[model samples]
Target chain A: MIVIDSPPLENCLGFLALSSYVMTLAPSISRIVFPKYKKAFLPKILLKNRRLIGVFAFLFAFFHGWLLINKRHIDFSDFRTSWIYCQGIATMIIFTVLAATSNDWSVKALKKNWKQLHRLTYLAMFLLTWHVWDKMSGHWTYVTPISMVAILSTTALYFLRLWYEHRAEN
Target chain B: MKSQRSKKRAISLGALMNFIVAIAVFGVGRVVWQGVGLRLSATGLESSHNLPLSAEAVPSIPASHTLDNQGTWIYTVALSPEGSILVSGGYDGQIKWWDRKTGSLLRTIQGHADAIESLAISANGQILVTGSWDNRIKVWDLKTGNLRRTLRHGDDVKAIALSANGKLVASGGTNNKLQIWSLETGQLLHRLPADTWIQSVAFHPGSQTVAYGSQSGQIQVWQLSQSEKPRLLQTLVGHQGMVGAVAFSPDGQTLASGSADKTIKLWNVDQGQLLKGLAGHIAPIRSVAFSPDGQTLATGSQDTNVNLWNVQTGYILGRLNEHRQAVWTVAFSPDGQELASGSSDATIKLAAVHDLAREAIANSPLAHTVPSERESDSQDL
Candidate 1:
């Protein structure tokens, strides 16, 4: 009954959009659900398991790209130069950081800097959501409800994590 | 008294010479063969007998190839029966494939809840099996890249291998057992028992026998055709560290085992005798593979190099030092024309076995890096 004019074709795009939203919340969920045992708890050689979660997230992002960059079977050539593509380009960049640091060597090589670089994943999550919204124009109606909920939920987790870290530092 | 001292000095000199010879031979081996003569590797080994590039090898053009992206830490690799596919498993619990030619990412088959420690592709190229830390073996359909089934296990699965016909698959891990499955019916046909925690498994050619190595430094052979009860056919004991990998020669007369003690041993299967001990790698050796023809051996190591050895002489033919990080997995193309390796560096590489014949690699995996810029825009954090 809440179908306030959202197109049927847009729902499929919503599929990719939904996948992204689900992925964007992974870190926040992992923190709240299994706080004591985030990826750092796995064996050293197996630490890539944690980073692998990021790989799948990025892959879902790519599938999102394929759908947007590809309309029908026309290919990347046929798509309009939408802001969504730029946002996609942005999301891929953040994912690349998460993916690159997936290795122990990358962790060790980058040292303290690696953790900071990975923190960029926070910026990327919202940018990617915005990118998805940009596809829907002013009314990506189907996605907007969930997006608003997720953005607020993730923002709450973010601030809570920040305050906790700051209090611990004190 | 003078004579005794002179004899002692002579004996010491002989010992020194023997040590030097062993080190020299271990470092590299030059085997002169019929065709596809080797182009010498920079590490000073002559691999004249590797598959001619025209046969199973193809020159790499990196820009055209989108190398596999599986886990951030790769542990194992295997070539599909057709050699057109390369499967790599990583510490990230993901198994990914790439086109053998262009190295483009063909598919990412996901299911394992933990790191995938090993992989095996069925000989007919129909199924790709993986053993994971999640305590299971997953059988995947090659063409569709879908997770077909998950064979539950009791502990971490360290190694996996498939038979030549694509009918049987084997997995070895935590409980010191080799679990064999029938791909056709999705039945786990048998579980090969072990004397200790088994580390690796390899199927002998043309038979139901499987050769496995263990943390106890013992390599046991289990014949599946006759009985479910594994026989203590041979205990290939020599290495001081754990036996990491084992392979049966194409002819089935010999078996090769590599260990963490930094030595590779060839055992006479029928005789159960240690034929020769190959030592050269500076660190633990991870996996060993025999080329299709059985004349050459490919080995990956913690030393970050893949060494090709002459099976007959136990001599190092040449060293492939391209992975930059530890080269945990290696496989030969079905036709024996190419060689592929997966490294901890998060990339899979294909080298034309024949390209070595040209005397110098025009370009290697070391020279190229993935598009690092791909990360800049995508982060949601």
Candidate 2:
């Protein structure tokens, strides 16, 4: 009867998380690796919407968490009982905090700590990787390609930013 | 003024690019998740927490006689009425019969050109009916493993059901036609056109009535009395997705239909009214069967779980998650002690339902507080 269930929504949440991760990474790449290329249209666009993208990612993560809690009927008491459940709940918590503090007011209030707090996105990314891998283990045919792309792109961007920063310092 | 306008334009362009990048990334991730989910459902890997007891933990439902090495998805399984032989047919297009006790292959009968989707064993266990994707229905002598006769259809045969007396075989398929045939003579007795592809069929126990569930989510019951042509009795409508499997309670009072909607609906057969909807599985339900005594109902789902429900109360008694892939069919042995489940993973699992249910009761805290009548009744059975 065309019932809207959890699986499709879960996929959507995964997509939103991925998009958020990429969006958050985009501005850093533009600022560090391609500082001279600031005029580039893609970099400028990503820099402008970085906060919005992060907020969206967090929203998606929240919805994902809500859906899972409702569908699985998970008891919060068992949060420490299962490793998979713990990892997922921890990731959601991180996303919730990041989303709550994504505004300019939090940036002004937390000052330098804001930057460090937002760095938890990297941790969230790592946990999400492990979560997806653990859940979709045998179905590598479907998961591997997208994961490789995300991982390789992030890694390549990180290295490029490091190289550019080193060159500027020298 | 020109420089200020240029700067503003650049900012807008950058915002647009961010939006585009976000959309692209989201799209890729969504596609990947969807693909994985579909593949998991197709292979029956979708996981559910409903089954706390893994296959190994439950010693009662031992991996008795894995008829493996066939190397293809087993779509349908049936145990002989006598419970001496187990027969499974699948994408391999070969029906393999095994000695139920020894777990040894007794015979492999081949005739269908394509995958066999549905199978039914007559009450006497003398005749075996199989509907195949090859658009053919073949009746075989269960004892000899010989094809008695082949009935051709206009499209792939999706489901088949044998009458209690084994005299009539009802089949429905992708052709949107339901045909009743004499198993002995292979003569097509009646052909009824349906609104959509028929995915599952069930014959009412000890009656001339037959039920067929369709892709359009409608369940039709027909009374095929010999005196009159087959008459449409009632249409049970509730399921939102394709009805994958339907089974009649042993007593013939209730009919259970499992659907891709991930719910099992029990209907009062005589009144043709929906009784209760049993919802637990996270994915599509592929098969459903009532225990021999009609007290418990077993449902196999694309979520890779075989869930046992108390038919009277619609409460989940326990879940069997032995299969790694979607469980396509579940059949209780004639005596109702053993529950047989076939999966897309190409393995047939024989579960001791009685023992598993007992263990569930012992493990559950509600054992003392809540008196589950169905659990006790199953134990008595």
Candidate 3:
């Protein structure tokens, strides 16, 4: 009998974080790209749960880092040393800060600064692109290329939303 | 003011965008599941008597033997000193012995509870040491198939090296601890802790020195003592990636290290100076071995290739692309006539060293730069 082995937990957690993070940003991109569909079923549901999805993304990313540190013995100092390793570390730290300030209490406490700080999600998205690229560039496995394509397409959608907003203003 | 048709079109586009995002999310899971399915089908094969190499890979060289692990990765292989018996340990947590000359299975030992990461044989081929993800080091009687001793570690073992005299075994792993043990007494001789994962370990063939490569791309050489703690000798830093394999030359003067950075460096074993950096493989190197004569170096990489290099000139003499997946380990027979490579493809391939070298030289444009046939013949003599 052929035994189908399960994929590594680290990879599963990483992919889950990526998916949830993408979900967190999808409503905003859709809002700009398809303003008429703001009241549509899919877009409305996504907008309603965006914050929950973002928090879930942070939790998944947190566990992903925890597994690497606790199980794989990855040194946290790698962020200061290697550029490739630093991308993921920096993204995780940004996600942590965003998650901490995600509450209404902190939103009221920080006021305008909370909005500016939460903008770091875009920075996380940018860093995550490089993190995926650096880890999967030379390695050709079954799931890596798919992941690369997914992350790139998501980033492209984010930029497309920005371009659309700029055009609308003009 | 947008028309109703345009509003309907916008909703469809939004739906399409949502669909794309959903596909991307599910695509990762689907691809990983598909990989598992592919592995499942591959594991059904009984033996890899004929390796399924691509047409481009087939014309290079024919392996003398293809020992199949039935779809589990073969992590490490070691040949006896006499070059007769070959022992291989792998992801299945089983060790298999093969008759090198006839390419026949001799025996199999199931000892490790998890994947066996490394294997080293004694100089006399009497004892075999295996390090595994099971967080244990096992010593086996090579001739009798008896379990000699089991040494426990704090974490899964990634690499191991047997000293030339067959008295000491050095092991390293995820624990960031490199520990030395006595083969006879099975006692921990020393424990050297580091700041990162220790991926590779090696012992000086002629001296009381040990070296280990860590995840931070640092190769640290230590001087062993009988009474006191092991003294840190040298910290060789050059590779941009983790050093996965390190081997001392037969004479024990030069240390060869292979890294995930896709380059191999030969270091002065005593002074720990980087003597030469050989760059040819496009992917991370997984294993490196020096020929018994110390003239040729063999290395395996995730590029699915086994490369043979002239040690003096740092020129690649041959490349064997027979394995379909990442080549995890390479070993030179005691006589250096044949080279055995274990791979993530679940096959251990034995290739003729001299024939591949001659073929590669003839095909290479830089053939004249390498030593001529007469010189190699004389060295063989």
Candidate 4:
């Protein structure tokens, strides 16, 4: 009825991007959240491959966007309608910068600034939450609610940890 | 000691933030991958189109024929009154006609410049009207496959319905404008405005009434007379999501509305009361139709299933899972013996609904299938 007709390939690529992006950040998060399991095999392997995983995530996201634009014949001239997708566009921009700078020379040249720039991943992730929610609220598939819950819970945990740490320090 | 504790807190907070981001990404990733993977095998061709035609059957409900390799999702399908000819249209802007009995492609019309969104055929089977994304509604002579007229719309024409009398064609689209036109002269007789885009339209069997479902989850029924303006009969609003399809029962006393909210509701036409709600689809419903006898309702959905429902009790009589992708449209043959479903997998599947009905009747004593009708009424369109 409401045909949002994206091919399976497009969806798969999007999923891959999400998965890799999560994996890229999962190790450190797990280390802090569950300190006892910080040395776990999965976390160690993920950490070792974190840079490659981040690059792969960016690649998948790039293809996903490209495919949608090409297949849908999206008209960029209609800024009024296109403005609704600003969050997704902004996230992609951050991913592009991260992907471009995922090299030794750029990291050395920028030094401490590189760390600051890479922190943009958090902002990108926050923006993506809004993007997915905005686009898929009414048109939810099985994965939509689960993704929302996991994202929300993890975000909540961050604030909880922040509050607890702040109270202990005081 | 305080500085050390602050640094440790920063480290943990950064890690926790990363974890939160990761969790969100992972959740979305799995949804796109595993969720869609269950419905579609996305590795190679991403569709079962490559499966040998011999293996197309699904246990009880057998696919009669598959119009193969359609290139993209077939958005809409219509069956002739007598049910011998099958017409389908989709993203490629081509209208394909198939012989119902032989399962052969009869003719392909390069109809529009954009994807065809909706299709309707006159009860007499003489006229075929197509609504397209190119902002045009084109009428074709069903017999000769020749274009008769092209009626322009303000925007993408999403829905169209032809009156049973073959004189009036009602169309609505993204412009939030529902326009009624003279089928013969291509003159716009009336234009009505809605709060949002109209996704589906249906004309009452009596030809004096018209109903349309909108993106805002509202269904409006109107009374139309040639001498006077169309009067609003009722505004039915219960669906939580967009109403994708609406069809009037054969008797015109009941209206069946299907919505993206994944539920099919039966409404009392005159009273505008919700009669019954049928919910079996796990995904959004795209199309709905009532059998000629008004005993059965067929609904197609993004869940890749076409469910046949018993209209009286609001129970699922049967389900056809022959489609590997989202079914965009479903239509019952005038005789009510066959069902043709068009899907995003680029295939049109013809199923034996009569047999499905019989099987359901065997399971539920209260259920009934359609009886045979006059043969002359099925003359090839």
* Model 2 bad stretches (over 4 Å): A1-170, B1-35, B38-62, B356-381
What shift in Å separates residue A133 of candidate 4 from its native position after superposition? 31
Tens digit of per-residue lDDT, candidate 2, span A120-158? 877776677666655434223333457547756775777
TM-score, cand. 3: 0.61
- Prediction RMSDs, each to the true structure: 21.4, 12.8, 15.4, 15.7
Ranking according to lDDT, highest score first: 3, 4, 2, 1
Better of 1 and 2 by lDDT: 2
TM-score of each: 0.54, 0.59, 0.61, 0.62
Worst 10 residues of 2 chain B by lDDT: B372-381
Relative to the true structure, candidate 2 reaches a TM of 0.59
Cα lDDT tens digits, model 2, B97-149, are 98777778888877576678899898887888898865678888899888788
TM-score of 4: 0.62
> Could you give me the TM-score of model 1 versus the true structure?
0.54
Candidate 3 chain A: worst-modelled 10 consecutive residues by lDDT: A72-81
Docking class of 1: incorrect
lDDT (tens digit, per residue) of candidate 3 on B76-136: 9999999999999986689999999888889988877667889999998799999987677
Q: How well does model 4 score by local distance difference test?
A: 0.76
DockQ of each: 0.01, 0.02, 0.03, 0.03
